[model samples]
Target: MKIVRPFSFVLAIALFTPAIRAQDGVKKDDKANTAISYYKDVRPILQQHCQGCHQPAKAQGGYVMTDYPNLFKKTEKEVIGVVAGKPADSELVKQITAHDGKKPAMPRGKDPLTDRDVTIIKQWIEQGAKDDTPASAKLPTVDANHPPVYTQSPVINAIAYSRDGTLLAVAGYHEVLLHKADGTALVARLIGMSERIQSLAFSLDGQWLAVTGGNPGRFGEVQIWNVEKRTLKMSIPITFDTVYGASWSPDSKLIAFGCADNSLRAISAETGKQVLFQGGHGDWVLDTVFSVKGTHLVSVSRDRSMKLTEIATERLEDNITSITPGALKGGLQAVDRHPTKDELLIGGADGTPKLYQMFRTKDRKIGDDFNNIRNYGTMPGRIFAVKFNADGSRVVAGTSYDGKGEVRVYETTTGKLVSTAKGVNGPIYAVAHHPKESVVASAGFEGIVHLNDAVTGALVRDFVPVPVKGAKK
Candidate 1:
């Protein structure tokens, strides 16, 4: 020791100090790690990010993580779940951590996992991924008879009216609940599809109801059901796992829908054949509406632009943006055309509903208008659904960014705020106006469909299709 060099002394301290810290770090991580069990640490992460595609009911790629047993089972692709104590060897870890431009990542449409989240997952697996779930954490096996029960408000993704306007089809978990338009009785439940019903539309003739949705990241499908027969007519499988805006043609011969793959496609109602594919959206296309004349189709997208395409020619009619395009920000989420004019009512993340003249004369066009006629403000959330109230004089918009569900009715021509429905209690995803009356129906996160007088905004009827005896929804 008396002859030891300065370098030797420093090296000894470096090695010894790290060893002490390593021991301390392990102690700390383990203390935190003790709380990391399959039910506690891992399940919440999967439920938020992975369950949409991996749950038992959907089981995309035959990987079901709805329970502890399902979570640890090897995937259908023959991928190992967790090699004991070896996150580096586990296929689940590799897939989630993988970054390849040639292939899409896990949780296809949403954000990827964080580094800390990855560490927690690895630690859980390293600790044997024990099943420590409490009794209350267990969920019922989801099936036709045991469909997903809403403990909280269920988001209404789509809604439609029968051609005759006698029945309303409200989107439900693995089913479409058909209710009397007046909300007086339950007509029937059209059950099919895996989950996530995005859009529903009764065929123009009202003979068929076309539904668009799928287990995101696993499969995207369009299911057509015969209204009277209440049977599946066609199940058109799409290449992507998510689709939006199933729009029926004016003649109801073909159905056009937008896909996650940034393409607009059409399928023949009779043959189930893909007839047209137009790729132009720079991002996800959110909604599509057939022009009243059926000569063109208008689509809005996350790209912050609304486009018009001529159907027969499949050519671009115009690429329209908001009035304050450079300043205003948010994806356009909904679009509905005037019943008789070429004007469009659009809503988006910006929390305002705007009326735009799709085809304006030179005299009618404003200074650098970009088709925007006027925008209605004062709404507190992003507009998710908008429609011309059968007559085209009034425009209705449903909004969602905030927790409070809001529906606004405005004078289509004057952009005057006519009526507003408050106390929706959650986001309003789908809204429809009675074809022959002043009544309007709205449903969303609350699960209850609320019928209101379009003029007075008075709640006339509110009913839950699948009522939870003691639950809020």
Candidate 2:
């Protein structure tokens, strides 16, 4: 039987159809409005592409993206790196999006961000750029009670012996391990900082030890410790991830170091005041040394330049490599000045350690020009550490490449190879000579601190500072 539908039934069908369409629209809106989290969605992009150049320590172009607070704050140049809820108005967004030929995209020489990454960053800013990172997602918290656990091998970066030749200090994971000069006993563990220790120097009086280092890409600091009391005397946090090649003034009144930010800085030993600052290098400042008279400071950098700064006036006295023209062809990594003369030694990626005369003029008015003496080609790897013997008769260097390390000594007057030691099994970052003996100490990727007889090139002492954690003593 054919029956016609009721008017109320037909009207109800139409009403429910519109209601279902409205509910579907609500679901679509909810998916579009899913909140974008900074830690979850944005941080990975930044850490992968941005943190290398834009972080708290090396905030390139005055922008830092490592932390939420620094990212949202305006820089000293009055340009805000990121603006909450306004991605288009932010400097970071502009730089990232300026991939056109008119303006350079950031990461400078690296590849630009992917389209997906850019969209996520924009959405994060649109969502107010909140700091949704959990406490555990932050950098490893460091404190006195809970020392930072260095999971990797203690890749030693520096080693020094007291002026009296009694105590030897070797760089540790987060402290300085002071051992007897003979390496038979442990004297003290100098603990104060929470990062890798890169360089260490004992004052002329041997009463204080100056340490330079920090967490790479996080912070940089100089810590002075009283050797007698084993107490921290002073702490100076720098404007980079870490520092290298710390040198002491002749009078032991100040300490100078080359920072990762390409700046040279010095601080007073008596007071923590910054006594000198000379921003001269275009790349990472790898090494620095004070003149024998303490009147001038010399520094070498990965920029392939060496600079001299007057201590009194804090002025760039000269750029040595500029005059010599191609004297240094690669990144200069290590520098050492003569103890009592106006000569210096430098080594780097060129795989050759060369000597230079600081001043050659009779009246000494003409300065800052390199007078290259000789190139010692005894080592074929990157020289990470260089030093002159106490009498300035010989120079020793530590080098490493392709997982191999070596220590070489050469006569200063001639480039004759005097002695060589090999089979370190890893890269060696530091080497030091005894003030009164022919002893040499080298340490690096290998955990063992290797001491050698500089004259014979024989391994004398192999001091293992950190044994395998779970292994038996």
Candidate 3:
């Protein structure tokens, strides 16, 4: 059994009450998708943080969450604990985060947990409710001598993990490489178009890679690769006058790019066909992404606006919400997803990066409301990229602040500061987390990949082998 926080007991007690769950998080403007996970991932985090007062013996506030079968025993509806895979449908998470200011997420006011823990809980609930099985919550950790192996890339920009967590995709310095997560053996290096690879993204099925960036002497192109055969699938010719971004559609059939042409273009992943080509931004399209709900698309442009379009028609939703000029516009640098939520994040154009909460509603409406139950934000450095940890509760933001090109973590809902990691002198260009652990491998302008301790915010290895107390070596 793990040590439980005290205040969380009070929260559980309050949360068990049928009435309290009903009044939990969700504002009129909140536009977040509901993802419910029950057993494997969800129950463990909840039991560890919330079971103190919610057990059958205590039955805090008349609520007993001892087991899934019994959770709805006395509850008015399945909405009491969670609806599995939908945060909006589950009142448990909302109550902990205190969506309506009724209660501040579990363990109350102080964040006794990290962002990773939050996301894992959310994902578990969203994935159809797994049991609090030891296997789901526990993992085989890497010992000092037995730690996983890997190779680093030059100017690495992005990374992706296979759904099974067996392989990882790395992009940087003109190539996209696939490697076994445990061995780091090079699987494939995307041939052709060798430039300082600026951005890389993997298709939903982990079948393809999308590469985008500009070089001083060469043109920029978005290349899609076949991971199994290690072959280039399609390349969208492009050039970023300054900066650019690349992403694959939810279905992984279309590739999109934010290019120097001030255009957002989507190309067929298979035939390399042009699916959609729309251009109208006053300046460059800084970043873009498909809404998780799969109903719309979004982009932030240097011209000072965040645009939302219905995905089915590639047309702006008739009443799309307006979030004029993100915090970083002309200097807009990067954008990242909420690992498990229907939210997207934006980075800055200058030295200081501010995180914004962008959420989409069930009806296809989007908004930037910090008070939203499903929407959350963070304050990071001159951010270039922000990606959700496997769970989506915690997000790592890549920074560009000189000497401060660090990766920072923050709680998604309360905006609570988590940790800051440092190692590079150049701008922090990209960051990605291991699918299961708190380890973060980052690449920067200085051309070095760093393996970092996500929880302690420490560099995984010592600079000169000086032994720190309790050092893993």
Q: Estimated TM-score per prediction?
A: 0.68, 0.69, 0.57
For model 3, the superposed segments whose C-alpha errors exceed 4 Å read 1-154, 180-185, 214-218, 239-243, 317-330, 350-381, 422-425, 461-473
Two-way lDDT contest, 2 vs 3, winner: 2
lDDT of 2 by residue, 1-473 (tens): 12212344346434443223445655744633656777656775676566645643345677766667778778667888889999989877887886556543775665687765676788778888889888875764343344446544577889998898988898887788889988998777776543689899999878899999877754577888898888777666665367888889989999999877678899998876789988778777878888889999999988887788999999998765544445457788989998889798998887788888775443323333336677787476898999998999999998889988889999899888888864456788898899999988888888778888888888887877653456554
Candidates by TM-score, descending order: 2, 1, 3
In candidate 2 the C-alpha lDDT for residue 195 amounts to 64
Q: Give stretches of model 2 more than 4 Å off.
A: 1-152, 322-327, 360-370
Q: Is candidate 1 or 3 superior in TM-score?
A: 1
* Best of the two (1, 2) by lDDT: 2
What's the C-alpha lDDT at position 214 in model 1? 76
* Tens-digit per-residue lDDT, 338-388, candidate 1: 877878888888888988887645542333565778887658878889888
Among all windows of 10 consecutive residues in model 3, the one with the lowest summed lDDT is: 461-470
- Native-to-model Cα distance after best TM-score fit, residue 280 in candidate 3, in Å: 3.1
How many backbone clashes are present in model 1?
A: 1
Q: Candidate 3 lDDT, tens digit per residue, 203-239?
A: 8887776777645322455666676776555444453
